[model samples]
Structures are given as structure tokens and as C-alpha cells.
Target: MSNVVAAAENSYLAAFDQPGRATVEPTPRPGWRQAARDRFAELGFPTKRDEDWRFTNVGPVARTEYELAVAPAAVTLDQLEPWIYPEMARAVFVDGHFVAGLSDLDGLPDGVRVGSLAAALEGGDVTAHDHLGRYAPFDRQAFIALNTALFADGAFVAVPAKTVVERPIQLLFVAGPGERRMAFPRNLIVAGEAAQVTLVESYVGLGTESLTCPVTELAADPAAVVDHYRLQQERTDATHIALQHYHCERAANVSTHSLSFGGGLVRNDVWAVLDGEGVECTLNGLYLTRGRQHVDNHMWVEHVKPNCNSYELYKGILEEQSRAVFNGLIHVHPEAQKTDAKQTNRNLLLSSDAGVHTNPQLVIHADDVRCTHGSTVGQLDADAVFYLRSRGIGEEAAKSLLIYAFARDIVDRIRLESVRTDLEEFLFSRLPKGEIVRQAV
Candidate 1:
């Protein structure tokens, strides 16, 4: 038998009693923080026995010792220059705490509130108080429970009824230089009835090898339109665990794009519910991994109302010895007649040792629903590569051209021009003979 050593400093339960948590002063039966802590204590870390996590093991996260990141690190605008978009109103968080000086939110419209969650809580923002932890459930999720129990700060945004936000807002979480520090960021986006908004969340840490766990909750009111994008670009030595929950009301249109480019081990858990009739929900994601990186995307979509439509598409490109997993499920309730849902997951393996595990599932309780699921895992077409090579193109450039073509469909579907351009540039940089790929595109 292999010997295992457990350290008290790394114990989550021991750290819960520490004096510097977000909810240090609290009381009541099953208070928000206490309740989450209790649940997490019961659940602990999931093992391979758990069906949802059987393919991806989180033992590294459970064993690593991390100090709670409650203070903001000194980060200058120059350091954020790479990720910052001058045209977008942005909120910056360093080591889980908001840094007002590094953010820019000028010329925001009336009835729109975007800032740090801690400030909103201290200043008594009614909307923030009413809906902070309303959507992300912590009872059954260990990461969500741990984040809720120990989270100190995050990003909060609220758009009022009938308003159109002309400027896109960005919430950037930066994990600064540290020795295995951990940060939990909780974000909430609330769009009122008939409102329209575009929002982006970015997690970027250039060289920091920290652990970041974030939970984001979004609610789209009746007839509202919400366009959301999430970008994860942490260092290759870091670990990231994230969860997002979205509620789509009657006639609301909600679209979310998840772009993951970096991190050593990453887990993305996403769930969306059609809460009312005539709702439209779309989920799209792209992930690229090299080296020994491992990435997993788990999605659960529920249709609770009739006449609602949901679409899911996720694609991954694995190189070297990298690995990836995609688990998508569409659950249709008995009353969800006329529900339409389609799920697809595709993977491209650039190396013989690269691997992928994809499971697209459908659980239907209604006979009138239309649901379909499909997955594909394969290597590049040899004849296509040969044809490109025969056309006087170098082997690497020819391969890059084909790779670019494979990913073009998803990137072209993005409506946000600036984000699309940046992602295109990013994709180009990752390809071999990337300039040839860009010119060919």
C-alpha cells in the first residue's frame, strides 16, 4: 500500500475556523457561509467513484496546500495592458479582491451598476443583496460550496429594465504572484425585463501558479437579451475550477461562449434552465491544450417549460500528451413539450498520444420533444493534408491551414467583433507557421 500524508495546514475544515474569512461575523441556523461549509465538510473532495468526475481526477487540487487570497496585490495598468480593451468598461480583481484604480467604468448609463461585490454588500445594494447566491447551488457541489464558504470578493453587475448597454463590460480576475495562494471569485449578472447587454469574464495570470475557483450566476428576465463570454488564460502551472448557472425566463434570449486556452488542470461546470416558455438558450465552447494539460467541460441543461429551444456545441484540439473530456446532458421534463435541443462535441488529436473522452447524452420525459446528441473524435485527414502539401505549401503551414479551417466555424459565429478579432489573433499565434495560417484564412 502507498503511504499518504495529510497536512493540517492544507485541510479546508481547519482553515474555516481561521479568523480572516469573508463571513467572519455571522449567525443563524444554516447561514449562507456556515451552511456551505457544512455541506462541503460532508462532501469533501470527489473521488473517481463519482460518476461525473470519473474521467478527470481532482486529487491534485485536494492535496495541494493553499493560502486564502484575501488581499489585493500591487498590479499596474502596464501589467494588465495585454488583456485590457480600451473601448470596454472593465472591473479588475487581484488575488480575489477588487482594485478600483486598475478598472475603468466611465460613462456608464443610468440604472446600470457594475463594481465590486464587497462594496455593493457594504453599501447595501439591494439587488446584490437579493440575488448574490440565489442561482449557484452549493449543497451538492464541493467546489461551489468551498467557494461560497470562503469567498471574500468578486464582480457584480446589474442592468435595469428596458435599457441597452452600448458598452461591453469586462470582469477580469488576476491571480498575482504567490506561493500556492487560492482565490474564489463569485460573479452575478442580472438583466431586467426587455434589457440588452453584453458581458465578458476573463481569468488571466501570466506566470502565477495559483488556484482559482469562481462561480458565476446569470439571470435573464422576460424578453431580455444577454450575450456572455468567458475567457480562461491562466498560466500552464495553475489550476482553475469554475461553475456557472444561467436562468432563462419567458421569451428571453441567452447566449454564452466559453473560451479556454491555458491552465494545467481546468474543470468547467455549466448548467442552464429554461424557466419559462419561449426561451432560447445557446452554449458554445472551445478548448486547446498542449503538453500534459488536462481540461474537462461538464454541461447540464434542463428544459422546464414548453416551446423552449437549447443548443450546445463544444470542440477541443489536443496536442502532445494533453487530454480533454466533454460531458453534456440535456434533460427534458414531462411538461416540456415542443422543446428542441441539440448537443455536439468534436475533438481533434494532433498527436498519437493525445486523448479525449466525450459523452453526449439525452434524458427525455416528454414524447413531443426533439433532442439529439453526437460526438466525434479523430485525427486530421491524411488526403486533405497531402492535397495541401501538393499545392506548393510547406507541411507545417498546410497542417495549420487545415486546423484553422476546423476551428473557423465556431470563431466565425461570435458576434462580438473585438473579442472575435483577439481570439483570431490568439488562434493564429498557437498554430505552427501561424503567419501562413493567418494569410490563408
Candidate 2:
């Protein structure tokens, strides 16, 4: 084992021994638990040298030890309303354990199962071993391995065949204040054949200091349709690392959105696999950062079969001395014919000190595939800003309008009105208003 592995093991052992960490009483399971622990021991965390992780570094994270997240600490609705979306089925996880009292899953449709991974595993309602940790590259990420070995609570959703769930299900993972919280917030969303549903997973942190490590896996069967959204809003002193993988079968449709607004250092790793013909996939994201924060998004979309289509668009705004990175790739395998894929990444720099790196890459092995990727990093359009100012719009308002317009394309693509509205409101709150532009003019 390498020094990195040794360090991770030491951290894990220390975390397990700490009384401050929440006691994870995963329902009594002998075989599955042992298997998972073995798998974790065999695989350690990944570093920047790894090919897929070359763009991001985990050195700072590796040195620090984090306990799994715990339940919210007496926070009122007014304190959390900004993080919660209205009218959605809510599932709450605090300190890495599901909080039944705070979660509301009363009106779910028939045949749809929603609960903690531990509860589901204990109840024998779902096979924890069948799909858990099955898709992620365990060898590459030490954090992933740690999560696999230690994840005590998670969310599981099952939609029956051809069933259409009109309402969206919300999963909220909260890491309360002063907690060395580490949570493997796993989400297994299996959409049965021809089934349709929408889900939103929101990660929030209370208090000043917290940590969240989350992994989610989503699978869609043939002809199924699913929409997934990941929203991250935590305290400024918080740290977060999340990995999401999506598998789409023949003729299936999968759409995912990532919205990030908080954390000291944040990394989001996403991979989408088109495993069958006629599959359609879309990946969209928006991230805004200020202060000394760092946000990284690395994504991959693979077309493994013929006649598939995928689109990716990510936009970001960086303020103050913050930094942001976007890396997206689309791969068309040799067997994939008639594939249509497009990727674009755009960034707006709000401060001269801010740093933004955007890369959109494409690899095609098939002859008859249409694929394109491009990335651009630039400042707001001066002409547009001037036009707005000439219209009697305050300088701050002018800049705000231009910035908002710059991000409108990605926001407008959200098919769900409720989610779209929620996102818009969040964006409005974070963006600079008419004042900043006027000062500049």
C-alpha cells in the first residue's frame, strides 16, 4: 500500500474511534456489510496523478479527517427555506443518517419505494449489494472507497414500470455545525421500463464547519425517462466532494442538472453511459462562487451503442478571488454509429483576480458520428453593458442583466417549472444587482 493509502486508513480508523462521530448502526447484516468493508479495504482514494483526476487535487482533503454528517441541529424552517424547494417530497439526512422525523414522504405513488439505504437493506426490500458501489471506480478515488466502507445512510428510489410520477422527490443531506461530518449520501434511482419520474438531491450544511462526501448512482431501463438535479449549498467553511453516475438503456431518456453555490472546496464528478440504442441524455450545470472558494466539475458522456444522442452545457460565474474549473468529455465508441453529441462550456469572470478554466473534449471512434465540443472563458460583453447603461439602467443593474442573460440558456432548458423557478430565485439572490454596474460606469 502507498503512503496515501496508509494515511487514509489512519484517518478512517481515527474517525471510527471518535466518540464525536455519529454511531452508525447499519441494520444487522453480516454478509453484505463484510463484503462492502472488504471492497473498501482493497481500494483506496485517488489523487491528482490519476488520469481522470489530473485536473483536480485531493491533497488538502487527504490530510484532514472528517466524520460523517449528522442531523440538523435545531434549525428552523426559516433557516432552511432558502435551501428547500416547495411542494416536493422531502427526505432529510443529517450527519450521514436519515432523519425520519424531519423527512416527509407521505404522498408517494404506489409501487414507489423511498427510504434510507440502511433501512432498505435491513428490511430486505432492496439488495444493498446488488447495485451499491457497483458503478463507481473504487480503485481510483480514496474518498469513494472511504464512503463505500463507512456510508451508514442513503436514499433509495424505485419507480414501477410505466409509472409516471408527476411530483418530484427531494433528498436533503445536511451536515450540521462544528461537525467533522463525512457522509456517503448514496442515491439509487432505478426507473423501471417505460417509467417516468423526476428527482432533486440537495446538499446543505448548517453551522460554520462541516464536511460532506456524497456518491449517487442512477439507472434507467429501456424506454424510461428520469430527471435528476443536484443542488449544493453549504457553509463557507464546509468541504464537499460528490460523484454521480448515470446508466441509460435502450431508448431511455436521462436529464441531469448540477447547481452549486457553496463550500470552501467543492468537486463534482459526473459520468453518463449510453449503453443502448436510441438513448438520449442531457447534462446541464451552473455554479457560482465568491471569496477564496474553489469549485471543480469533471464530467464524461460515453456513447457505447448506435443511434444515440447527448448534449452538455455548463456555465459558471466567479467573483472575488474565487476559482472554478470545468472539464467535459464526450466519447463515441467504435460500435456507436449515427451518434449525435454536442458539448459547450462558458464562464464569466466577475473579478480580475478570479480564475476560470474550461475544457470541452470529444473522442470519436466511429466514422458516421456527429460530435462537437467547445469552451470559452471571457468577461461580460462591454457593448451589452453599455447598451443597458444607456437605457437608464443603473450600472449595477446593467451588469446584472447581462450576467443573467448570459446564463439564461441553461436555466431555460429545465423542463420542470418548479425547479426552474427555484433555480432562478437562487441565481437572483447570489448575483450582483444594478449597483455594481453603476459604480463601474
Candidate 3:
């Protein structure tokens, strides 16, 4: 084994040995923790040799020795007020532990359960035991394994059958005052038959340098509708790795939107399986990177039944020596018929040193399937810039306008008004001379 791999293995073993690092009770799935650890030990971390991980390396994560974040830190709502949405129900976690004082769940609808995973388990919520680690299989992925083995706390959301939740549920995770530390967060969401719900998962970091690994599993029953949004806006010096697994049953509708704006090294893995007929799935993402940052997004969609539809669109903006990677795969099984799938990736580079790698693949074993994919990587249109400049717009402002226009395509698709407005404000602030545009708004 390589030295980096060995060092990583040692760190994992040491962390596992620490007291109270793993939270597993005897009543609820006793052997799962051990099974996950064994799986991680067998598979180890992914290297550059792996085709799926060829562009992104895990050496930095593996070699770094980070202590577990266990202590509870004080964080007021004022510190998080800017990011909080007043229209949504909130559940907060700080440094891997749920903080009741910082959370608000007033006026929540009936037939819905929202709280911390640890509390749910202790309260004997059977649904948590039934679907905690089912969708996100840990055997094939090392990061998932690590999360399963060491997860301290996360969010749990369940919508009962035939219920409609009009308001969105927000899961906020904050990392505060811990340097060289790591936290594992796991979430499970289940939408029953004919149920409708929306979820927003946000990760914010206030610490200097830390690492966060989070895994979320979503299951939608027949005729159910589930909308999920993940927003990652951590400290520029922090590292983030996240995984999401979605299962759509017959005639179910599921949509996921991911917006990534901050982090030093970030990787996101999303997988969806359409297991029943007439299902609809939508995946959309936008990522912005600058100042030597690295972001990677990997997605896979599997069509297991007939008459299913899937659509994917991902956009990226890179500047100032930043780098990004996008890898997407659409697979149609032999038994599946009339599967309609479309995938597209578009990227904009602002600086000469900025770089992007995009790959979209389609594998079809069914004769009656329509699958298409495309990818593009380029700089801004000089003609458009010139046209704006000729109209008395400053050069920098012209570039900013073009960049915002390029991003507006993805932003307009967001259904939630509050989320859309927040993202617009955040994106505008990151642009060059963006304060001028903000003033006009």
C-alpha cells in the first residue's frame, strides 16, 4: 500500500478507538457500525487509479489527522439569521451535536416528524432503524463507509402517507471554533405514498480549518413528491465531502438542486434509482469556485423500470486558478422500456488559469430508450462583452452582467422564492464590483 493510504488507515483506526466516537445502541441495529467499519477497512480510500475518481484525489483527506468535534459550542441565531428562512421549519446541529436552543419548529404541519437522528433513535423511532443506511450503500464507497462508521448526529425527516407539507423543512449544520477537526453528519428522509414535502440541507462553517463528511438518504413512495435542496457555503479553508442517495417508487416525482459556493476541497456524489414505472426525476446543480479552490460533482441515474423520465443540468463558474470536475452517468437496464433521459453540463472560465473537466456518459441496454448527453467548457463571449461596453457599460460591470446572465438559467428553475432570492443575493455579492449591482437592486 502507498504511504498515504497507510497513514489514512492508521488515522481511521485511531479515531475509531476514541471513546464516544461512534454512536450505536444495542437495541437498534447492533452490528451495522461494525459492518460499516469492516467494509471501510476492506475498501480503503479511492485513489487516482480508479476511473470514477481519476480527476479528484483523496490524498489530502486521508493524510490529514483531524480530531473529532464533540464539544458543543455557543452560536446565536443572530449569527445565522442571514441564512435562515423565516418561512421554513428549522433544525440545527452544531459541531456534530443537535442544539435544541438554536432550533425552531413552530407551526409545523401534522403527520410530519423532524428532529435530530440521535434523539429519534433514542426515542425508538422504528423508521429510523428501518431506513437509516439502506439507500447509501457503504460497501462500494469509502466516504460513505466512514460516515456510517462514525456518524455522531444529523437530521431525520419523515412525512406520513397522504399528507401535504406546504412549508419547507430546513436542516442547518454549523461548524464553529474548531480547527483541524472533523464531523460526520447523516440524514434520512422518507416520503410516504401520496405525500408531498420539501427539504433544504445547508452547511455553514465559522471555524478556521475543518472537515465535514455528510450522507443523506431519500426514499419516495408511490405517487409521492419530494423536493430536496443542498446548499454548501462553508469557510474558504474548510474541506467538505457529501453523498446523497435517492429512491423513487412508482409514479413518484423527485427533484434535487445543489448550489456550492465555498470550500477549499469539495466533492459531492449523488445517485438516484427509479425502481417503478412512470417515475420522474430531476437533478440540477450550480457551483462557483475561485482562488485555488477545487470542486467535484459526480452523479449517476439508473432506470430500472419502464416509462420513466430523468433530466439533469449542471453549470459551473471558475476564476483565478480554480479547478472543477463534473462526471455524470445515465444507465438504462435491459428490462426498462421507454426511458427518457437527458443530461447536459456547461462551464464558464473567467481567468486564463482556470480549468474544468467535464464528462457525461450514457449506457443503454434497452432497445426502446431515448438517452442523450452533452458537455461544454469555454470562456465568456467577447462579442457580448463588446456589445455591452459599446452601450456605455463599464468593462468590469459588463463582464459581471454576462456572468450573472449565464448563471440565471439555473437560478430561474428554483421553485422556492426565498431560496431563489437568497441565492441571487449571494451570487451577486461574489461577482466583480458586485456591490454596484446590489445597490441598484
Per-model TM values vs. the true structure: 0.96, 0.90, 0.96
Model 2, span 1-441: residue lDDT tens: 586566766676555445553333334333443454555565545666676666566666667776544343555556667677768888887766777777788787898887787677667665444556557755556666566656767888888899998889888888765656566676677888999999998888875657677878888989999999888888778888888989899999999988888888898989899999999999999888899888999988999999999999999988999999888889899999999999989999989999987777888899999998888889988898898889898777887878887778988888778878777776677666734533442
How many backbone clashes does every candidate have? 0, 22, 0
Tens digits of per-residue lDDT for model 1, 1-441: 122323322377666777767772112223888888888877777778789999888888888878786687788999889988789999999988889999999978998999888778778787788777778889978899998888888888999999999999989999887668888988878899999999989999843568999999898999999999999888988899999999889999999999999888999999998999999999999999999999999999999999999999998999999999999999999999999999999999999999999999899999998999999999999999999899899899988988888888789879999989988999899998899887777
Model 3 lDDT, full chain set: 0.88
Pairs that clash in candidate 1: none
Question: Which sections of candidate 1 miss by over 4 Å?
Answer: 1-10, 24-30
Clashing pairs in 3: none
The C-alpha lDDT values of all candidates are 0.88, 0.78, 0.88
Which whole-number lDDT from 0 to 100 does residue 416 have in model 1? Answer: 90
Error (Å) of candidate 2 at residue 317 is 0.7
RMSD of each: 2.3, 3.6, 1.8
- Per-residue lDDT value at 135 in model 3: 87
